[model samples]
Target chain A: MKIKADTTVCIGAGMCALTLPEVFDQSEDEGTVVLLRETAPEGQEEAVRRAVTLCPSGAISAS
Target chain B: MSDLTLPMTRQRPFDPPDEAAELRQRASMHRLTYADGHVGWLVTGYAEARAVLAHPGFSNLAEKMHPPIPSRLDLVEERSRRGVPRGFFLRTDPPEHTRYRKLLTGQFTVRRMKALEPRIHEITNSCLDDMEAAGGPADLVEAFALPIPSLVICELLGVPYEDRGQFQEDSKLLVNLETKADDVIAALGRVTAYLHGLIQRKRKEPADDLLSGLIEGGELDDEELTGVGFLLLVAGHETTANMLGLGTYALLTNPDQLAAMRDDPSVVDNGVEELLRYLSIIHLGPFRVATEDVEIAGNLIKEGEMVGVHVPVANRDPSRFPDGDRLDLARPTGGHLAFGHGIHQCLGQQLARAEMRIAYPALLRRLPGLRLAVTPEEVPMRSDMTIYGVHRLPVTW
Candidate 1:
């Protein structure tokens, strides 16, 4: 699965980073979503989906 | 249209009000009657709640909204007053809300909150130590649940923990639905003045804390700084305190669920989310007014009309959460709106989570013999208050 994170819309609740740190990190200054990788690693697709669902702002999406 | 009034009676302590659940079953959105005879919309379904919260057509401005219950009318008026003190962004809509919220977002990021986990552990263990020393037949609410978050927030904001007694009482009055308008104003005044004094002191002698950090940022004026401090101080403690106390009661009663958490260390993360969803402590959901005509879940909410989301009901919607009534700790509670949803979703949620993640497990591990000292029915519920939870949880370990 491929992930996309929009920092502009991200309110920085940090669900993505908390859910899957390897794939998602928050910027230190603004705390907006910082996508570490575009594609989910093997066996981590489920968690990536969960992160996208959990994001309060709908700033994260996966395809 | 439903005849049911908002803030329906809770038949069971752990479940949402029966009337609310029934309303949800009938439809996601209902034309709810407010206490003052104002006909408004109530969103009960999980998807509906999420939509209303996420929708930009809704306004959080307190002046435009009506309270679902009569008692809260005073609160709405007090919050909606002209020139709502700067930094009180919860009641304001973007770009004003956006400006205030963004200033603090970085402070509560996932990494920063995780970094504070160690401090949270320390605070939790210390509270547990005090509870143990005092012996088992203590009110867990007073001894454990309240202090863990209280102290954590105090330390984080650089507010002296010794002053908790003053702020705690003031905060109680502010959140109590029954508090009179005059009393609410008094409480708000006292807390704001206290924060203003503290901010002045911090200016003279800067400290290493969030409040000090804000001062260093040089963004907010004195009044705004006081407003921000007031929000953090009150929001930081009361919500989490109720969660910790009420969550413990939930665990002790549901031994199977508690055991699952204790037996497996990994369940703590999911367990916290499940507890948040199950309890859904914020009985009164966020109130909003339609900025323009909007249709949600086949229901039309017109401009200038009010909308109240019944969070407890929405979180338990059968469509979103199968076996919605059950308290299953292992359930994948990813999308729960316990902290709410959308831009105004709780600013302090990450910190609250870090505290709970450390607290519940520590309590279970430290007090294996913990159980209720009084009957569950005897525990005083905060049904009269804005935030729902036990007022006092008497427990004996």
Candidate 2:
């Protein structure tokens, strides 16, 4: 699975990083998503999918 | 009960007013009479309130026409106009609101707020220190609840911390329901001038703050910049401060919850969410005018009719939250409208949550014996103002 975060649209509501810290991190300065791994870790796909849904700005996607 | 008014003032500070509770039980929405004698619809159901907030048919532009307070109509009109001295995007609809929000979204992302958490802890500790030095019976509103968020917002926005007293006075006038039109206008003028000068300074010397970031970004001109700054300054502190004050009151009065928070470290995150849902500090939720006819929960709300969501009542709706009226710290309280919903939900919600998450535990640990300095009945609640909270939370440790 591949994960992408659109920095322009992310409002930094923080749900992504909070839900799946292993798969995603946030920029300290910009507060937008900083993708930790392009592909989801073997067992973490469900968590990553939840983060995408929880993002208020629709800034994250996984496929 | 066709002539129900919005926000029937609470006799008990912690719960929704009796009239509001009655309306919520009767139906989700009711035809309402405004202080101006204009008729509208009041939504008191959780699902209905979310639908109204998220639906394009309901326009936030209604703030100009049907402001909750009778006396603020002129001020609201001036503030809601197209170009000059515009109200915050809280009063604007889609494309316009979207544009303004996009400019600042990057500034408030969750990771950015998390980076600021250490500073939030420092600020909370400093306030507790001040309270400790002042001795017993300190007004929490004056000492701890108000200042922590105030200082943080001032630093975040690049507003000089020394000038907080002046802005605090001006902001009070702006939100106080009984404030005279002349006073409100004068305060508005002063705040506008201060922000204009500050924005110019930022243009010349961009600093490491949100205001400086907006100035360097080049998407906004002076007036829009002032609107954004003024909105953030007022909103950034006020709502969260109330949550701190009123949430403290709620917990102290309900000892079991307070003990639960004190004993268990894990409950702090969920506790803040519960407090937000229970207090619903922004009690008079945003008002919107139906731009077109739409049916909500079997009710036909006609075009141009104003609609409002009573957040406290909707949050406590039994159908949505099991045993909804009771404050349960352990409950999974997601989907609450405390920060509102839809595009205009809240820009600083993550920041607010971070502050609450840090501040609450720090206070509990620092001042373990903290309790009310006066009886609950004696504490003055800010029912008449736009935000609902205690005016002074006198506490002793």
Candidate 3:
């Protein structure tokens, strides 16, 4: 699955980073979501999905 | 129209008022009568609570909002008239709220908060050491629960820990539902003035702290800085302190859960989330008003009508959390509304989480025989405060 993040709408609640740190990191400057990888790694799809669902601002998604 | 008032009294200290569950069972949203005679909607179901909080149609603007209970009506009207103080973004909608929230988000990122874990541990250990020195049968609220977060926030804001006596009293008055409007205003004035003076001092001598960082950002003026400082100071300490106090009370009462956490350190992260969900310390959910006509949970809410997300009830919505009333530390507790949702979600949530994750485990390890000194019924509760927690948790190890 490919991941997408829109930093403009991200409030930086950091659910994505907290839930799946391997796939997501927060920018030090603005604390917006910084996708560490464009695609979910094998066996980590469920966690990537969880991260997207937990994103409070709907700033992250996976397809 | 139902005549049920908001914030029904809790018959059991650990549970939300029984009326809330009954209301949720009837429907996700119900007609709510506010203290000011304005009939509004109360979102009781977990889905509806999330919907209202995340919906753009709902606004947190002071003019559009109403307090769920009667006691806060005067304060609400006063704030609406004067307008929300600059940098107090909690009462404003985007892009206004966006502006203020953005200025502070970087300071509270997951990584930034994680980096503070060591310091949080140090603080927790220090409090535990003090508690040990004091001997058993102490008021945990005064010894352990209150100091950890109070000291953490104080050091973060560059505020003198010596002045905690003043701010803690002022914060207590600000949160109490029974505090008179005049007294509430006086408390607010004192906190603002104190923060304003601190900001001026920081201007002359910048320090290595969040307040100094904000001042260095140069985005906000003196009034705005004071507003920001006021929010962090009051919110930072009280909320987490209650969670620690009440959370310990919960674990102590449930020996199995306490043992589970104490035995297996792996459960600490999810355990903290479960405690947050179980306690749901902020009893009165964030209040919002419909900026335009909106439908929530198949119910049509008219424009300009107020809505309160009864969070304690919403968190306990069985549809979202099966056996919601039970405090199982291993429960999958993601997406709970304890810190709220959407852009207005708690800015200091990561920091709060860091504090709890470190504090709870350290506390349990330090006091292996920890249990309540007073009988369950004797412990005082902060039922009258905006944040629900124990007033005094007498405990012994």
Using DockQ as the measure, which candidate wins?
A: 3
| Winning candidate number (lDDT) | 3
Over A1-63, each residue of candidate 3 has an lDDT whose tens digit, in order, gives 999999989998999999999999998878889998999999999999999888889999999
Candidate 2, residues B314-356: lDDT per residue as tens digits? Answer: 9999998988889999997877889887667788988899999
lDDT of 3 at B64: 73
Question: Each model's number of backbone clashes?
Answer: 0, 2, 0
In CAPRI terms, model 3 is classed as high
Ranking by DockQ: 3, 1, 2
Q: For every candidate structure, what is the RMSD over all alpha carbons to the true structure, in angstroms?
A: 1.4, 3.0, 1.1
- lDDT score at residue B299, model 1, on the 0-100 scale: 80
> lDDT per residue, candidate 3, B250-346, as tens digits?
9998999998878788999999999999999987767888989998868899999989888998999999999999999999999999999888899
Q: Which stretches of candidate 2 lie over 4 Å from their true place?
A: A1-12, A20-63, B62-64, B73-84
TM-score of 1: 0.97
lDDT string for model 2 (A1-63, tens) is 999888766655667777888887777655567898899999989888878756655788999
Q: Please, what is the whole-model Cα lDDT of each candidate in the order they appear?
A: 0.88, 0.82, 0.89
Instruction: Write the residue-wise lDDT of candidate 1 on B1-397 in tens digits.
Output: 4676885578888898888888889889888888767888888999989999999998987678776888877666666674456788787788887778778889899899989988888888888889888887999999988998888889989999988888999999988878998898888899999999999999999999989999999999999999889888989878999999999999998999999777788999899999999999997767889999999977889998899998998999989899989999998788999999999898889998988888898888888998999988899999888899999999998
> TM-score of B chain for each model?
0.97, 0.96, 0.98
